[model samples]
Target: MRIYLYILAGLSSALIGWNIGQFFLTDIGLFKEFPEVTLFPCIAISLACGMVMNEIFISNPTRPKLSWRIAKTPLLIAVGLGTLAGLISGGISQILFLPQIRFPTPIVRIIGWLLIGASVGLAEGLTWRWHSMEAGDPKRFWQRFKVSVLGASTASLFAAAIFELIRTTLGAMPAEFKGVEDPLGFSILGLLLGLTFSITNSPSYLGALRAGTGFEYTGENYEDIDPNLQPVNKSSPCIDKSILKFVNNGDAYEIEEGLSIQLPGTGTVRIGSAVKKANIYIPGLPLHVADLELKNRDAILKPNRVAFNCIEVNGERLTSGDDIRRLKHNYVLTFYSEKKDGIKEPKIYRFVYYNRFLDPQA
Candidate 1:
C-alpha cells in the first residue's frame, strides 16, 4: 500500500509537469522563435518527474522535521541526471525530425520518451547506492550497480513500447479528440515511468525507534538524533544496528550521542564501552557488556561479565550468567549506570525497536 503511494506521486507530478510544458511550448509560443529552445520543456518535465519521485523515495515519517532538508541533496542529484537524459533525447529527437531525416515519427517519439524513463530509473539506482555507502555498507556496491543497470534497461524498453502503444491507441479516437491524444499519452507515459522506478527500488525492511519514557521530549533536551538514523516510514535497503548513549542531565534523562551502523548478516555484535572494539559502544558500560546475536529477525542478548547488573530487558533486570533474552518487535532494552548517587540521577538509556513491515503504523 505504501509502495503504491510512491508510484502515484511520481505519476501525478510527471503528468502535471508535461501538461505545463505543453502549455508553454504550444499555447504560449514560448519557443517559437528558436527551435533549439524547445529542450526547455523536456528538461522541465524530467525535473518535475525526477524531483517528485526522489523526494517521495527519501521522505520518512519518523523525522518529519528533517525530511525535506534531507531530501534536497538526493533530489538534486536525480533531477540533474534526468535533465541530462532529457537534453540528450530531446536533441536526438529534434535532429531526427529535421526535413532531411526520414525517420518514422512514432519511432522517434518512442526513442525520446524511452531515454527519459531509463534516465530516471538509472538516477534512482545511483541514489540508492549513495545511500548504502552513507550507511557504511560499501560491500553491496556491485549488487546495487547490477540492480540499477537492469532497472534502467527494463525501463527504457518498456517506456519505448508503452508510449508508442498509447499514442497509437489514442490516435484511433474520433476526429474531435485527436488533439487530446498527446496530452493523454504523456500522462500515461509518466505513470508508467514512475511505476517502473518505484517497483525496482522498494526496500525489504523499515525500522524506527520509540522513546521508552512514555513522553516525547523536545526543545533540545534529547541529543541530536543521528542524521543517519533510518526513517521509520521509508524503505530501508538493510536492517540497522544502532547504539544510543544517554546521560542524566539533572532535569531528565537525555540522549548524549547515538550511532546507527549496518547490521551484519551473520556474526556476534559486541556491545560495550570500548570504542576501539565494540560495534556499539556505551560510555560507562564494561568493556564487554553484552553480545547480541541476530537470528531470523530476533535479537538474542547475552550479558557478559558485570553486565548482568547493568542491563535490563523490557524492565526486568538481568539476574544470572545463564540468562539470555530474545527480543523482537517493540522490545525495550535499558542500560543503567552502576553509580549510586551524584549531582545527577543515575544515567538510564532506553532503546526501542519497531519492525515497520510487521507494524506499518509504527
Candidate 2:
C-alpha cells in the first residue's frame, strides 16, 4: 500500500539521520557511553523494519532500475548543496563567531564544513524530497523553496520535540550557561542548517505536479517542461497585463501626446506622437501609468524627465485610474501654458471602467 511506502520513507529517513548523527555526536564526546546504550541496536532494528516493510508492501514490479535512478537525483542535489553551505558557514564562523572564542585553523575548518554539509545533505534532503514530491514540480525553484520551508519547519519541530522529551525523561537537559558546551545535551544541528537550505534552494509546487504526471528530468532544468507556467515578466511594465473595458457605446482611442489614450470603453488606443508640441499632464491619480505604444506592439510609459511638470496620483501618474466616473467617456486635455497660437490642440483622454484589483473569479 502507498501508506506503507510513506511510512517506510519517513522511518528510513529519520533512522538514517539519527544513525549518521550519532557517530558525530559520539565523536564530540557528547554521549560518552552511547555504545553501551541500546540506541544503536534500536536504530539497526528500525532500518531492518523499514527495509522489510518496503519489500513486502511497496515493491515495484516494473522499471526498478529507472525508478532508482529517478530517486537518486534528490539525494545528489542535497549532498551538493549541503556541502557548499557547510563550508561557507564554517569559514564565516571564523570571521563572525570565532573572534569571541578560540577557533580552528583553515584545514580544521574545512573538515568541519565537510562534516556539516554531508550530514545535512543526507538527513534533510532524504526526508523532504521523499515526502514533498507531491506538493509541486521539483524544477519550479520558488515552489520548491516554499515547500522546503514547510517541510523543514515540520522536521525541526519533530526533532526538537523528541530531543526535549528525551532530555526530560532522563533529566539530562543542559543548564543555561554562557559559551559552554553541555557534554550530555543533543542538538539537531542539521535541522537548523536545513531551514536555511529550504529557504534558499528549493523547487516549486509545479515540480510536484511534474513528478506526479510522470515528468522526467532528462538532465535538464525542471522548469524546462512547463513553458506555459513561466513566471510573469518583471522588467518592464509594457509587457504587463492591462485592464481595459468597453463602456456602453463608447470606445477606446489613442491621443497624440507621445502616449496611448484609449477611448471611453473603447479598448484600442491610437499609438502615435502628439500633434501639438505642448506636453500633457494628469493630476490626483496615484500609481499613474502613461502607456505609450512603441513600434512593434510594445507599450510603455512616457519618459518622466522629458515630461517633468506633472504631479503623481499615488507616487505614480494615472495612465490608469480606478474611478471611471469623472474620467470615463471622452475628455480633451489642452497642453502649452504659453499662449502663442489662438488655436489649441486637444489631447483626448478616455477613462474606462476597470477594477485593476478585481478578483478574476469575482
Candidate 3:
C-alpha cells in the first residue's frame, strides 16, 4: 500500500514540476538541440517527487533513515483531483465571469491547475480538524479551527517550497520563480515545517501545555482530540496484582496504602489498621479485634491496648501485647473469642503476600 502511494505521489509531483520547468521555462523547439541541459531538470523532478513522497507518505517516515518508502496517498490524490477540479473551475470562470483566467503559456496554465489542485487536496485531509469545527463551544471551536488552518498551511508551504527547491536545484525552475531560489530560505522553511510536524505529533510538550494536568489517556478516538493534547505515555487498564487475599471469602482485593477490608462472620474480621477505629470492628464479636494494615509494602497487625493480650501468631502467643507486628507470609494468626461457653477453639487465618516481582503462576 505504501509503495503504491509513494509511486503515485512521486508521479504527481514530477508531472507538476516537468510542465512548469521544462515546457514553460525553456523553448520546447530547442529540446533536440539542448537535450543535455534539460536532462538535469528531469532528474531533479524525479528526485523531488521521491523526496516529497518519502517525507509525507510512510508511517514514521520522518526518521533519519533514507526513505524509499512513504504514506502520502492523500497528497497524490489531492494533486491529481485538485488539478482536474481547478482546470474545470478555471475553464468555467473564463467562459462565464473572468476573462483574466487565461494564461499565455499553456504549460503555465496547466501547472497552475495542478498546483491549485494539489493545495485543495492536501488541505482537505492533511489537517485533522473536524473536532475543532464541531467543538461544543464557539470560542474553543474557533481556536481549533485556527490551529487546523495553520497546520494545513504549514504542510502546503513545505510541499510547494520543496517541490520548487528540487526543480531549482536541477536548474529547471524558471527565472520568474527564481526569487525563492535561496538555500537559506529553503533551509528556514524546512526547519519550520519540521518543527510544526514534530510539535503536532509529539504528546508530551504540547499535550502537557494543553491539558494542564497530569497526563492521562482519556479517550478512544485520536481524531476527536487534538494531536497536541494527548499524553506521551498511553496507559492501559489492568488489574493491580498487588493484593491481599481474604482467607474466609477467597476474594482478592488490591492492597494499597491505608487500605482496609472487613471479614464478615460471627463478628467483623477487619483487615488493615487505623489509630482511632478498627478496620474490622464489631462491638459484640467477643474477640478483641485488631486492624491488619498494609503499609509501605509491609503488613501491620496491631491490637488495641485493651485487647493487647488477645493476639497470637503462628500458634505462639504475642508477648508484646500492645505493640504492632509485621505479618509475614504463610504465618498463621489465631484469635480467641471469649464466649458464654468459655474460651472456645480459636478461629485461624493464614497470612499470604502476593509478590509483584514474581512472574505469572509464581
Q: Model 1, 1-362: lDDT tens per residue? A: 65566557665666666666666677888765443236434543463445344534444556555555545656776767766777778778788888798999878877776676666656665655333322223434456546655665565567567667766776777778677665566656656655655665555343333444412333442224654443343111112134322111212223223322333444577766565577655555566778877654556788985677888888898898678986666777777755745536656766675432222211
Q: What lDDT tens digits, residue by residue, belong to model 3 across residues 138-162?
A: 4434554455346535554565556
TM-score, cand. 3 vs. native = 0.26
In every candidate, how many clashes are there? 0, 30, 10
In model 2, what lDDT does residue 302 have? 44
TM-score for each of the candidates: 0.60, 0.28, 0.26
Clashes of 2: 30
Candidate 1, residue 240: CA error in Å? Answer: 16
Evaluated with lDDT, which candidate comes out highest? 1
- Give the runs in model 2 whose Cα sits over 4 Å from its true position: 20-61, 84-141, 172-362
Between 2 and 3, whose TM-score is larger?
Answer: 2
* Candidate closest to the true structure, highest TM-score: 1
Query: Least accurate stretch of 10 residues (summed lDDT) in model 1?
Result: 244-253
lDDT of each: 0.56, 0.32, 0.37
